[model samples]
Target: MEIRRTPVLLSWICLLLAVFLIPGHCFYLPGVAPADFQKKDPLQVKVNKLTSTKTQLPYSYYSLPFCRPDTIVDSAENLGEVLRGDRIENSPYVFEMREPKMCQIVCKLTPNEKDAKDLKEKIEDEYHVNMILDNLPLVVPIKRLDQDSPTFYQHGYQIGVKSPHSEGKDEKYYIHNHLSFLVRYHKDEQMDVARIVGFEVKPFSVKHEADGKWNGDKTRLSTCDPHARQTVMSNDNPLEVEANKDIIFTYDVDFVESDVKWASRWDTYLLMADDQIHWFSIVNSLMIVLFLSGMVAMIMLRTLYRDISKYNQLETQEEAQEETGWKLVHGDVFRPPTNSDLLCVYVGTGVQFFGMLLVTMMFAVLGFLSPSNRGGLMTAMLLLWVFMGLFAGYSSARLYKMFKGAEWKQIALKTAFLFPAVVFVIFFVLNALIWGEKSSGAVPFTTMFALVFLWFGISVPLVFVGSYLGFKKPAVEDPVKTNKIPRQIPEQAWYMNPIFSMLIGGILPFGAVFIELFFILTSIWLNQFYYIFGFLFLVFIILIVTCAEITIVLCYFQLCSEDYLWWWRSYLTSGSSALYLFLYATFYFFTKLEITKLVSGALYFGYMLIAAYSFFVLTGTIGFYACFWFTRLIYSSVKID
Candidate 1:
């Protein structure tokens, strides 16, 4: 039975690794399948939220004085989309498959003082107008000198530009009133059908003049003459947005056949120019892992083996008394440390975070959370975190029981509420700030209620069930009995002080992951696509190994010095990496970002603080477990009577 179980476990482990580590393109998203269209089918264009890197706040698409549909109905949003501040809605711009339309008007708008002020503010902030057609996001193609084709695509076009007036004095706001769209489609020769593959737009500011008295006819403009094939040109008079000015919104749609297929349409959007840099980051991380692995192997094979062998050969207590180092702490090594309850709660929360991240990454690497499915990643993370409450409760309850604590319910409640409550408070504060800005990034009351429901209704009950099950089982027995009277710890060198050693122990783990951390920050703050889940999963594994190994090494050194307070030290030692992560984020903020708004700055730091706290929990938990296993294996190998 043991032999069969060993093979079965190994097979399962291998299968799990394969599922997580495989290339993302191998598997497709389940519900978001590809769409095919027949000839002349109406393709509706939808507008998404307006985003700006400068502000880091997304606003509703129709918040500005733009053309709107009659009903102005919002598109159905998933949890992820809502959280991401995506307010997708139907636009007045309509299209037909394989058909060309020229100089079609999309409603004219007369701006009020408030509208003008809002448009000027958005233009000054450099917000982009995001649009979607057939689920493909519209992009502004940027030409590159190195490439013959326009491979680099900006996610969205700038709403308008702030240019100096003709007097070359004060700057004036110019809105791009005319949009020339090029819709690329893949045609099927056999079935006489086509699929929309690309949506590109070239924006212009054309001041139109009517040939005759305008009676609300859309196609009666001299500047955009349809008969002679005249179109909006960049050199045309720019449309300066001012209060009470009538702004005519016009668009042209041109369809073109493309070789790119619907299945691989997102390939172009996901192609980044920093592929080589990502590879270099992976190599650097691997080198750090290899170095740490070598050090750990030496400690395990040479030093640990010799010490265990000599200790086991002792004939009497006198001989054992002469022995120094880790052997001296056998009686007190497993002793519960001060504030063990808090430690248990932290470890349990870390377990929950670890499970959530691991599962989310697995799904991401398997292509279930693709870039095309906006907000899918955030939604998956949130749902997974809620479900992982079970692990949190079980781990905390088990640890508390082992520490000889009888109040299982109290420990379970702490495990479920402590970390989450802190995070929730911080999130709520940040949401309030966003609400003050009147930004769509703020969480709605309905969503907040739903979150509370998930916590209390589902997660809290699941945690209680797990804790009950954990407490019902027999408590885990320590390998060696802990003495009733604690042993006195010896004075150590200044370098071995808890704070100093923890700071030192965290350096290597931070070094291993800082490279990848750059790209993650860029993706979040700079609004770039981050689909390199395969590299991310590898880095995550490396980060885990580095954290564990470093903590084990530091714990061994501390134990050899007759210090038995390994419980919290092991956690803080690896967890200190989060301190460095937060510091690096601060540095990134000052040097890389150009954010000027106070609220935007606050938002960045607030979100980063949450991220750093999560990192601390995850790394600290890994270290505690590694050191626990190390101490147990070492002490159990010798006679301890």
Candidate 2:
């Protein structure tokens, strides 16, 4: 029995894991707590004054004083007490709960801190509630200087908060908490602006956190969430600073657990998982395995066998069928793709991108970048994309030379400029739109100039080198020559046209994640949390499979129709996915997203263009290779005079 080793084993394992194990064990941001810190030497400090404090904190906050004693004191013994007693019922406020529960709370401060503390005492005296006073870590100030203007500063630091649970084991912890700070300024300007700048998750986690629980041994703490670090500013004098400096940044934490517990059940597994991103990634990885299996099987078993047998037969008989498919088209196999210069540049860039995707997926699968890694994945992808310009130039020049395009200097120049120019133009326009909205994600002007500099300095040299190598290599020789007379065109149905079919092929995949697209768009435009890599990963798989299969089917039709112009068809068909992506964004604007016209329209189309162009090159490559092989195989089988 012939054994298919690589894909069969890999794909089967992936599929089983996804179907049976993923749903339960693949939480997004799992085991995200700090290491358990035992008091090495308990500070001999007395609570000079025992005061209970209650303040309405933001609903999104999911932290508490876990490290050191803080300004705010609670009446309850533990966090559960505050949730059960002080929470309002059926109120419009964010923290307003039904009788004694709050679903979504973005914190609303009650009376003054003293009044709130008095209320806490009254509630405790009348009805007993568990109140616990926990100490928190000290906040460190950080500053980010504008490279262009050093004087102007953007202050921010990495916020590291640890949940009160062990690193690996799934356990529940308290959430209703607030950070109280008393800042004494040594010296300050008479008038200056002060505000909380930015906060981000740090990469200190040793293990993944399932849902919100820390998983692993109790002796160790998960670094998934260290602390919330923020850059604060103020121009208030020392007296005012001290008076109001007892600033309480109240917040609540999310406790990830299930009402019912099962050791190995799906729900329990999911509960123990990290975050929603893991769910999407698992699905995406499974689909990719499926896709690779199908494609490899076709290549190794069906296509390879047929091609080898035909080659042997042709040599022995010295005669072949007239209707040989791919074999008959060998001469044109190395023909320059349309828009040779542009195509060369794109393809070269695509090679680099392909490498990045492989590396990223491997890293992710290896657990260095589980779904719980937050922006680590995006940061990696961004760096990879920026650095892959060399591949774009190289692949483009090499392919162009293979196709007998000899304008080396021009091809190199085009390759160097194609991606950087287009991206810069698109990004600039998007930044302009973002300028109006005051969105932080906008690429700054200095960064844009730096991009230009890099393109000229880095990409240009690489392209020149790549073109030199490509030109130095000999042109690929074809096994067969094109006949003087063109084959008669066959009548085709409406659906057979490349344009129409490409449009049709992209619809289903787009539909599958149109709802998901809104979440992504909102993150980019409205600055919402999009840490759902699992969902994004799933959508990516759907997109790739849909593009590949749809393009392949379309290319097959064009070939059967005797349309030798199958080159562009393969590309455009797969590229049509970009069009659908754009269309979905447009639809999202009207139905799902809420944004002004300037930010909405510009960013929408700007990103669309990039997506479309990238898809065009990727899909085109797949189609061209597929059609080329098919043509060569069929043509080679034919008898020649």
Candidate 3:
């Protein structure tokens, strides 16, 4: 009986272990036979990258293949779907690869004589070879993604155009496109395969020209464009062949097994772009740091020392220090600012933005958020911002109440809804436009409603809770007493004018990060992968330091001029960096981008405004806090009567 009971216990233990292991292993061992594995498809074809040979730039393959919206079979795309950054289209026009001989004709570029003549007539009688609007050019325009890039990430095109060069007197020869092949050996897989790498502009033979056969020696099979070599074109510029050429495009495909994974295919290109831009950014940021540090050091060591000594000597010497500088306006410096409530709200929003930025950057550096992860960065940012709403409300409510106010409810409401509501309204409008265009980048209606629910249900309630805690306490105690009557501000010098000083301070911080701005814009509009979050995090820290130091130095100068209007001036001085950022973006748009559509231009500027406003809030808050500490330290140290 004892032996039977012991065996039963051991059997129960074995059963429990099997239960745990089966669930983790998909429980397929019982249902899936070994024969079933042989029936599954061995491989799948995915949409690869689009690239141009002339510019060596990657583009979205979908951008070039113009398919009619009415012909689309499916709809209801979401922001998360776009963020996933996969080839969203299921059509073969976007991506399809198989045996080269199995390629099918997708498009035919037959020249309509009437259409060509109409386009020629529309050309402004510019005397020379014909030039058109390029809207229906023989070549295609494309945009690509950060992730979901193709193998090798090169380019290939087989557009047949009429070659001016004749094979022999009357024998006209048309320019033909050939796909370059690469022979690859797979070590681990023990197989060999050939792949189509790119398009050959000129394919020639090495077994003697008269043989008309393939050759290993690289040579051009077609005539070079003499006029093209003479003229200069921008990088990734559109191709313009002699008008009225009927270009028939064809495809050649092949694949080779390799140890290299898909993720590392574009590593070389991204590394090169990052390395060059990172060095330039570091050098520019160092120069700005040196200038800002020099100014701050002067104020701390020379200016502040002399003023403090003079005041101290006069105090003990039974002499009165002249009331001509910053001390003269001490009575009004801490007097609650006009629109204190609004300023509180701005500061709160700034704090929230600042916190969200730091958290996002931190997550990015940790590799938790990445382009490959598809909406990981954005989803993280939105979640963080929602949770961080508590801080925004608390900061605003605490500051507002500290100003001897009783309107905690008003402060909380604005803190929770003001900027977020405005952003959502604009976002929905833009999304509506995308939906109208039937773009895959549009967010689904259900996702938008879900976002609204998160905002109102979770974020708003958290804000209210934080405000309640903040208002429960008494107004913050002042280190120095305020005079019953406000002191008169002395006339300021031209150099001390708020706007002039702001322009100077703003330029310095902007200069520190402007080089970085170029790379960021390239990553966004150009769809290049940005994996250098470590460098970005460093730049962010430098920007904060530059803003704080510059604003503190400027605030000191304003006080020296007996100006007590430093409340708004202090915030705007550092916050002015955003204005320069916007101006620089406009400059970049006109000079760097080839965007021609009116809607694209509008979208570019519209999104830039949102970025600038967020920057203003972030930098402005930094400046305000630094000045606040500086004022408290100086006033508390002095013997004010």
Residue ranges of candidate 2 with Cα displaced over 4 Å: 1-20, 23-338, 365-375, 436-439, 484-491, 508-546, 633-641
TM-score per model over all chains: 0.94, 0.53, 0.69
lDDT of 1 by residue, 402-421 (tens): 99999989998888889889
Model 1 TM-score (2 dp): 0.94
Q: What digit string (tens of lDDT, one per residue) describes model 2 on residues 395-486? A: 77667776667687887787777766787777777666655544334444665565566567765786687668767777655556755555
Q: What ranges in model 3 sit over 4 Å off? A: 1-41, 47-80, 83-252, 257-266
lDDT of each: 0.86, 0.44, 0.58
Pick the lDDT winner.
1
Q: Which 10 successive residues of model 3 have the least lDDT summed?
A: 128-137
Query: lDDT score, residue 356, model 3?
Result: 94
Report the Cα RMSD per candidate: 4.7, 18.4, 13.2
Could you tell me which 10 consecutive residues in candidate 1 have the lowest summed lDDT? Answer: 22-31
Best by TM-score: 1
Please list the residue runs of candidate 1 whose C-alpha ends up more than 4 Å from where it truly belongs after superposition.
1-27, 145-150, 164-169, 227-231, 316-318
